[model samples]
Target: MVSRRVRDIEYAIRDIAVIADQVKKKGKKVYHLNIGDPLKYDFKTPKFISEALASASHSGKNFYADSLGVYELREEISKFLKHKDNLDITSDNIVVTMGVTEAIYFLLAAMIEKGEELLIPGPTYPLYINNTKFYDGVPIEYELNEQDDWEPNLDDLRNKITDKTQAILICSPNNPTGVLFNEKKVKKIIDLAGEYNLPVLSDEIYDQITYERNYVSPASLSKDVPVIGMNGFSKAHLMTGWRLGYIYYHDPENKLLDLKEGIAKLARARLSASSIAQYAAIEIFKTKSNHTVEMVRKLRERRDYSYKRLRQIEGINCVNASGAFYLFPKLDLSGLKKWKNDKEFAIDLLKKTGVCSVYGSGFGKYGEDHIRLTFLPELSILEEVYNHIEDFVR
Candidate 1:
């Protein structure tokens, strides 16, 4: 027995990608608007990042270092958190992982017991739900009301809590939606979790990519409650292929010592995440260059233009994405006589318009009529995509 539920789920977006591949084989320049990978969208690693990696590659520190990450890197991360999120994170609380994906997976594996539940937001990232199932933990999803600008429904959240709710995952500047959590909402969720004595696993990989409001770490709101703040350099530093990420546990009183030790053990068992990647990450962490800032500025510009363009389109309605590189637009397939669902719409669009976007149905239950488009493409391409989509929808 593999001790895993191998057949329970299939990442459907990747499945759709198979069809997309056929389109690519046909020599139709398919606009890849599906994945959130910033590097694929003309983003280059900042000069500081390259310089840091170059220095490390030349350095004789070719061997593996501490499992908790390099001492200097952890220290720099602590300083960065203190300055950026106003949290008093120390090096002791930080555990470097391959990426935020590994950090989340590790944490879920360590903390989740059989039959326990993780409260995930609907129309959210798929990994949270998948990981929950992989651990034999139930994923109890609460829908994020799109009509409410895609904020977490507090009533639904409060009602969803039970004795078995081990943790609640919050992805601010959330994927698909790009809705940044406000201080009030964060406080409420923290308070509710505190009441139930549950942990909050915060995925903040897109923190630095915000356009309108500032990204707030849940750990900053309360030192009293335990918060596992997961972040990595993949998105912000344009180092997705580097596979470097880390997690910070702000337990305040060493409440997570046992769990942290287990995570460290798991890290060791994996023989430590890519040593070269970690070395390169340490350098990226130390620099305050214009690379990430410039990327954020460009993404914001794209977000504004895309929102305007999509809104102008007669049948497409998109939420104003405040962060991240995606815009989830609800297509009015009601008028289209052929397609009945977003999947068919996506297939038809790829076949007709050569615009590839993953259907929103893959984003859990609530995203039936939607499609996720990464605005990471250049302005001209976006303009062209809008023109194509407009013509197709009309």
Candidate 2:
């Protein structure tokens, strides 16, 4: 009887080891800008994906391989999304899970129904609010405006739909505000989920981790809306522990074939997701290299040097993140009057400046006074994590 929803998703990163044990009891040098594992951030993985996983582990092609995966990696994910997003995809609307975090927990346990409702927006990506409360559903949210850059209000997603909502999650170049939605505001949230017929779940695992805008896929702005579209090879092929991931589906006449057969019976009960990492995701999707275009030009030069040292630190503000490798900011804490909110100003700035980052109120409820920061580290450790967060916020 130990599933109090997997013990509240195992205390969701419990303030990352209580801020890495208060920055190792104050010896400092912490700097881990709170999680998004690009192989712990110096990003390595392509040597043709470790030589096609050492030639499919000596060419035996290991055991389990067809739980909707490895049909030539879903025919190389339908020729890598019809040569990268010219989409009208195939390979039976793909599935191949075990990464876009189990293709977003088997597309929210195959299109969320138990007590339904999903919505999503406010500082999203806490695993889509812990897989919509571990599949019992009901996670709603809808705020985004950090002064119109974190964009997505569509009348607060059409007044948080009803008739038990069911779906509408998004995550553009967005996971803690890397804000990229504008393709005419993603065709007006795919015509407001095709006028509330609902079904969107679009994570796009940081679509090639963008920078100066252009990573669209809300199923290429609506084949009349029903888009599951998750993606992976974890952040454009750094292959986050090569768990591999995929989940496309434009709308097989929309009932979603019993939600793609409950994600192919939970991808044949998790029986596949590593067939030598799908034969090393077919040599990292046919050698599309330049290592994610030099890791998105060094994450747009660490999002322009941490958005110019978080706008010269006076009551921080940020939002210039035109792609992933997060930023979020927004920290006045009004003269730090012995803080009480943004998770006690990020656990008192990780007990005064070891700088571990993460409390955008754990990515929901309109990120109470913000803090997500992950400039993926190194530009001299993000210029000493911006001079220890501007000398612990002055």
Tell me the deviation in Å of residue 71 in model 1.
Answer: 1.7
For model 1, the superposed segments whose C-alpha errors exceed 4 Å read 1-4
RMSD versus native structure for model 1: 1.7
lDDT of 2 by residue, 1-394 (tens): 7887877773324556576776787687666788877678787877778888888989988878888888877887898788878887788889787888888877778778778888888877787778888978888899889888889888888888888988888888888888888888778877887787787878888888887767877786777667888888877778787678888888845657777887788788877777887887877666646888898898788889889988998878887888888888887777656676777777677767777788888887788788888888779888987888788778
- Which pairs, if any, clash in model 2? none
What are the lDDT scores of the predictions, listed in order? 0.84, 0.80
lDDT of 1 by residue, 167-269 (tens): 8889988887888877798889999888888888899999999887888788888767899999998998888888888899889766778898899888777
